[model samples]
Target: MRVRRKPNPNRNHPLHCPYCASELLFPDEETEFAWSCQDCLRVFSVQFHGQDDPPVKPEPARSSHEALANSLKRKGHEL
Candidate 1:
């Protein structure tokens, strides 16, 4: 018996190339997780190391002491 599978819609979520955002990315059938960009001509592979999350940006430190001093100076109470 021949079984026909349904086509996936969300499979092409990230269809653009990283190097060139305007380029279309094509997956290599011979290699798993391998992708190529038509415009940039870049051949790369995708892999998930379980948790390959994006880097987090550090928050700027609050200057409470300087702010307090500035407020005091504005009220003519220089310290």
Candidate 2:
């Protein structure tokens, strides 16, 4: 039996906000498999397996890891 492996969630394609040169944030309010940039309001989808055209999505800054970690602790996630 062949066991399929799950794709790495942290692994993502290199992305940039064409407008502000800011690295586009991944995953907006719609889905976790997407990304977006607030500076230019441009959305993008990353190819996890190095295939398919990049998609787009709208995302905010607070969606980032550091910000999210802070939010989690604030909401009571033990450090």
Candidate 3:
């Protein structure tokens, strides 16, 4: 079975400009998955993989090992 999507004019699809962090990148052709960032004046393409996986969750800034290494470095314990 296949699923169809209904278009909603008021629906907000979130996408930000990687360079300028602006949300004004409009599509030159949505079917072609091409987008243009007005703030950066750059054009880019969005690719969707076949897998229906969820968006990746953000990781922490430092893992336990990294935190331990930084702690040792501060105490003059060179590895």
Steric clash pairs (candidate 1): none
Instruction: Give one digit per residue, the lDDT tens place, for model 3 in 1-79.
Output: 8765555344334479767888998875444566788888887766655666569867758988999999999999986
Judge candidate 3 at residue 35 and give its lDDT. Answer: 71
lDDT of 1 by residue, 1-79 (tens): 9775554433343556777785587875545566788787877766554655469866766599988998898999979
lDDT of 2 by residue, 1-79 (tens): 9886576576465567655778756556455455678777777655555555558754645757788789889999965
Worst 10 residues of 3 by lDDT: 5-14
Query: lDDT value for candidate 2?
Result: 0.65
Q: lDDT of model 1 at residue 9?
A: 37
Candidates, ranked, TM-score: 3, 1, 2
TM-score of decoy 1: 0.41
Measured over all alpha carbons after superposition, the RMSD of each candidate to the real structure, in angstroms, is 8.0, 18.6, 11.3
Q: What are the lDDT scores of the predictions, listed in order?
A: 0.68, 0.65, 0.71
| Least accurate 10 contiguous residues by lDDT in model 2 | 24-33
Native-vs-model 3 lDDT? 0.71
Sequence-dependent TM-score of model 3:
0.42
